[model samples]
Target: MSLDIKRPNSNKTKKKMGFIVKMQLHNNNNRGGSNKRNLFFVFFRSYYRWILWFFLSLYFFTSYFAGDQSSPSSTTTTRLLSNHNPSSSLPSRALIESSAIVTPGIFSGMKIYIYDLPARFNVDWVTKSDRCATHLFAAEVAIHRALLSDSSVRTLDPEEADFFFVPVYVSCNFSTSNGFPSLSHARSLLGSAVDFLSDQYPFWNRTQGSDHVFVASHDFGACFHAMEDMAIEEGIPEFMKKSIILQTFGVNYKHPCQEAEHVVIPPYIPPESVQRAMDRAPANGRRDIWAFFRGKMEVNPKNISGRFYSKGVRTAILKKYGGRRRFYLNRHRFAGYRSEIVRSVFCLCPLGWAPWSPRLVESAVLGCVPVVIADGIKLPFSETVRWPEISLTVAEKDVKNLRKILEHVAVTNLSVIQRNLREPAFKRALLYNVPMKEGDATWHILEALWRKLDRSYRRSRVLSE
Candidate 1:
């Protein structure tokens, strides 16, 4: 096991090299090298997040908040306006950037290309609804003007449309029924519109009409007779059931607002009436009138659902308090109803044939706390507005106990509730004022429809996979 070992030439050369290296290190440490290294680590541990956050925030803020508003038709600005605080003049770039992730520009620059529906669908449809100052005709006017005037929403080209607006005035056509077959005209018009859409664009056929918007704002029993499969009044065909339906009478048991496609929009207010409500101040802002009701009290005994008068809510209220000192009751529509609404501390809004009533909007507009008696009714925009804050809902069966319910609301509490109703935000909710008015009824409904379509798209993608 012999091994040959070579002895070190390291004795002279290795020792000299090590000594030189050690002297260099000692000289560097003496000149504060260790202090500089520790100081560098200290700074890194203390302020790195603030530095990183500042740059990341800057990138996103410049991208979203500074969106191209100069494009008069830009939806990007509206989307940005919705997600930020209304009073926020300028938020810190980081705070806004954090929110930008969740509030995405899904519809930025997206166009709502309204179909140039035949004159029958629009102007002619106006004649059918304009005979009276009611919700159906009012809706014809409101929905039509909102889309036509809002430059930010409409696009002249169908090819660029993100969502198609089908101006199907089903309620307006149905308004002409006089114990005769008036539903035929509306049904024929709607059927023709659907046929035209199917023939003209692959959009309806490809999506099965899921991307369309139909404003069928009528009492369920009054319109959409197609749900019954009636040949004459069946305006909304079964194939188009997937489209977004906007109406006021979306009862929970029937319409079930929890569903994806049904949107509960505000019933129309006459332009003059809205202007009048907006022009005058309430008298003393006091509950001088204990309660007020002015409408038909006749019950449709055969109509047991009591959507309008079948439930005996009106009859019960009239029977119990018809001549009460403080409660004012009118058996028919009165001329001073608007003034009465402003005077009343609580306005009685009983069901007629549906859970929703136009009086809900009227009362809110005039700064009266709405005493909603619609059973199983889902209030419109309830996702954004808390109903109980500015209104009260008594069970349809509790119509007789209306006074007791009002009694429970303390005078102090009633004042607070009235104050809530008086808010410009609450008033804004009850009316589809006009175009370019942010956060009004029409704006909320369209925004809701956009969200519905977005969710539907996501769901379909997941299913396809």
Candidate 2:
């Protein structure tokens, strides 16, 4: 039994023991590797829902932000040209390239017939509007001047015309004696025109002058109708209100061009401003001042609540932030206003007796960003013009916070806004387009009137029914 116990070799036994040790070590190593992988899997599984939630939240937020900007927002440079007439394209790229101010197509083969209004109705108001420095509303004469230009859509024969241009200077009838505009005189002018048109043509009787249009930048101009006294509704003459009315103010709740029959038009741009903007470079020049405003600051305190209360805004502006650092203010029109504007970065176009003004144009020409203070004043050619892209709008309430708000604007952003003002689309759409330029303010007006006429006609029909 003792001899048998010693029979196994020590080397063999040692070799077998070493082999068993190596196998156990290898298995332990494999198990160790597998456990690490298992630990990773466990960690991933525990946070699986959190990871999914994080990604889903990101996706939802991204979609919401994208939806917010599906079309250009109010403050963006992109224009919203809604195809009101689904069948036809707008006066867009191709039309712009061709420089067709009033194209024959979207005009839908329709002709604009200018009413041979007595020179008195249109001419008498010219000097009156420019009587004061800050008080001006010359759309009557401006529109008349636009009509004088060459156009393919204008028909020499009124019989073939689909729209009538009534060149009436309803705003000019003011009494210099009391320094006040007589709504009575304005009414008389309107009344005389209505009588003449009704007696002369069967057209006004047909659609109640739904096809006629007039441009009046004055707030009191459009409201001077005897319709309130008449046995009719609408508080204005049926024929005049039924026809298209173009005014400087856009969509007002009452007076100064109301509703679909009203198309917002730009205040006439001065020839000097247009010329300067044309000759000047678009980006990066010497801009000296932070903000520039030089006009009448004396606003009547009694009439402070009115929407077109030009006085109240000026009062607020002058009272709160006048004669401050980097903020220029003058009681009288600065003789060097253009020079100052040229050297400045921002020009304050506050309400001056009315909402719209030629100052807005002057600011753009001098390469200054306009700070529009007039509430509800729609910049010219707004249908195709992106106003906020070119200017800063401070509401009447924010006049007190003017400096702080303007200071927040980065210099980098101001450059882009100033540069955007120089775009051809904006120039053509916002300014009185030079002879034969497509996207002219007048052409846009015709296009707007053309689209609006059909809908307006239908509405009038329904109202009458």
Candidate 3:
């Protein structure tokens, strides 16, 4: 059997058939000789479809051309605003949009260009010592690794980048003497990285390193010295003075160490380590120890070169409350110190050489209330984490009244503080993950950088374009 297919323009045949029917009606209904009226009806009925088609085509053509003439910048602005995830929290949107920077939703649109430096600048140190990536001063390695795997914010092209991240591992040089990292070669290593970038790429010279970012996760940040007096004497390097530094050292008062543009970031603590401690902890979450401290607490702190360790704060605590039953303070390092943190009610976070300490993050992450006794110390992620609600701050001069202050809090708002500390957001904000999770330390660092987008020369140029 054979089959026949209809022509592609079958609608034309239907229009012709309707026109013929209208003609037959016009011819048959003219009982009187009113020819003009009959002819007018025939004309309108036959050509109405063509008129409608003409107007519709004209409307669509005009719309297409008008869209082409719209400004590219306005289209880009709409695209940027529409890129925000609907599932993101309202507070995140408010935090991103509150700044009247170059555009809206730039927090989501932020792009960083990480330099592809030689392995000697970064990964070689980690290979040399496993402690390079897990130590207390390992924020440099953590931020670098996290950003390398982050595709949402990292861009391969340098021309489109908002900021340049120079991944130099300055804090990985460990000394054989004290097992602590030596900052002796930090300046030279970072300075050599700057020279290499300037020679190979134009980004460093374009802004004179103003739009670049670095991590100085040490006692005095870019000063790269453990002692404050020595750190002040040799201030931030000249090459890194204009760039941004992510540091663990900060203060409410003016100081020579934190003189450059910087963001206060928590000292690095491995996420797996925190998870292991939480796993080994009691299922009911029982804290037995009253007030715990397990670091240096000298009976008589010697004055060396017009300075004292912890500015004599830890020494005073030992002199005042050494033998108290409630105060379980020690001066030795324990292998399972994190297990101890999980069982403590109050963890002493007194000043060491710097105001900030790794114990502040450890105690906060382990569900222990941090009794921060460092005067004028600035904590990290204050914008996202509620530091005051979860922790207590005591003046360095009030070492004798430490018991009274903690007892008063325990009687009044201790439960309130413990409830706040148990929130997962607080724990996530202080720990750095390898691939990076939402609300983690690296993410908060990106949020802090997002607020400073006004410094992005490319964004300004993009808006003007």
Candidate 4:
């Protein structure tokens, strides 16, 4: 707060010293401030860099780990082919080949023989007509095709072919009052036929101990009955009874035959094609009530339509409701009829004299709600599938209520119903060929029998040794 002055020389020295001391103090203070500013900047820079690095590392690491976890494994790619191989307990190619071989002819390796029957069999309803000849010809054709495919098959005279494949008419003596064959009679006839063939041909002598597989296009019960009766009549050992594989289309437990493996082949129509066909058909309002019965009624004089109901009941229903709804007789090739059924709210499936018909498959394929009339007739392949889960089963007495039920369905949501019926079993039945799919079931049972037979054959060989 006070200033002092001095002599010139002493004052000059004092002033210089004082100036030097003041400069040194200011320089010290400036150095301290600079050090503090530099330290603050270094701390700030390191904190920001650490945060950026942490976030970058986290983002990259998370993305890499996520990609690894989301990828699928190789095991999922080959799952479909896994169940089809013989090594996995399925039929081997050798077994199928041996079974398919026509005796007395060349011993060809495994091959599938497709038998195409003449259209006449479909047309002929009565027995002893040219239809029987057609049936025999169809069988012969199948055998011929099999032999032609393989040069190894020894071609004998028509009477002496190594194997004879026959398509027994659905109307044979073995069948019931309905056109379907009787299981017991069918089995007996088949057994006798096999024996007759064995006695007639020398080639079958070696096959006696071995198992043979046969696929019949007739109903399942007929096939089973034939096989069972054959085993008993031939005095086939108890062990060998299970060795025969018979593939059939229908299944009924009440029949005397055992339940062999079988497959249900349903009719199928492509969805888009069906929709387009329906668009061209006449409106439901425009269809005449008596159009279906005009001409065909004479051909089917008993007035027995294949399904729906008996002639008497159908007549009553027509009389009562014919004015309200049109009833058109369905031709197999009618695209419009198929489309109308496909687009309909409900499809009526009254059992014919027979419980199982092609119509059931057709209805399911169309995605139409099948209204099943549960009658005394036993359903084919009912053991393998649940009818109610996919279809609406109505009692025979309740047949009159079909219209009301359909009306109710129209008010309900249809997409949900379609979704419910589209199961894997239904799809497989619709897509695959009937005889081939039946052959697959036959293959399964035959494979098991073959394994047993092979073991027996091996044991006999060892005993002989």
Q: How does residue 64 of candidate 3 score in lDDT?
A: 81
Q: Could you give candidate 2's per-residue lDDT for residues 1-465 as a string of tens digits? A: 355456657699668756765665667577876555555565566679999999999999997886454322222222323212223566445223332222335564556777786766766566546642123455466566666675776777777766777777765566769664455566567678877888887767777777777665654336543222221233445456766778665434454235436777776655555565445533556676878888777754444334334657878887777767887787785554676777777788887655666778778755688888877766666655566677899887788888877877644476678667666556666656445345656667766776664634444555789
Which residue runs does candidate 3 get wrong by more than 4 Å?
Answer: 1-106
CA RMSD for every model? 11.1, 14.9, 14.1, 19.1
99-177, model 3: which lDDT tens digit per residue?
A: 3322323445899999999999998999999999999999999999999989889999999899999999988888999
Model 1 stretches astray by more than 4 angstroms: 1-107, 127-129, 132-137, 174-185, 221-236, 254-260, 277-283, 299-308, 455-465
Model 4 / residue 283 / CA error / Å: 14
Clashes of each: 8, 2, 0, 14
How well is each residue in 128-153 modelled by candidate 4, as lDDT tens digits?
Answer: 44433232112222322233344333
Clashing pairs in 3: none
Off by over 4 Å in 2: 1-105, 123-135, 177-183, 224-235, 252-260, 276-284, 299-311, 433-436, 453-465
Write the number of the candidate with greater lDDT, choosing between 1 and 3.
Answer: 3
Task: Estimate TM-scores for all models.
Answer: 0.71, 0.66, 0.78, 0.42
Ranking by TM-score: 3, 1, 2, 4
- Let me know the TM-score candidate 2 reaches against the reference structure: 0.66
Q: What's the alpha carbon RMSD for model 2?
A: 14.9
- Give lDDT: candidate 1, residue 294: 91
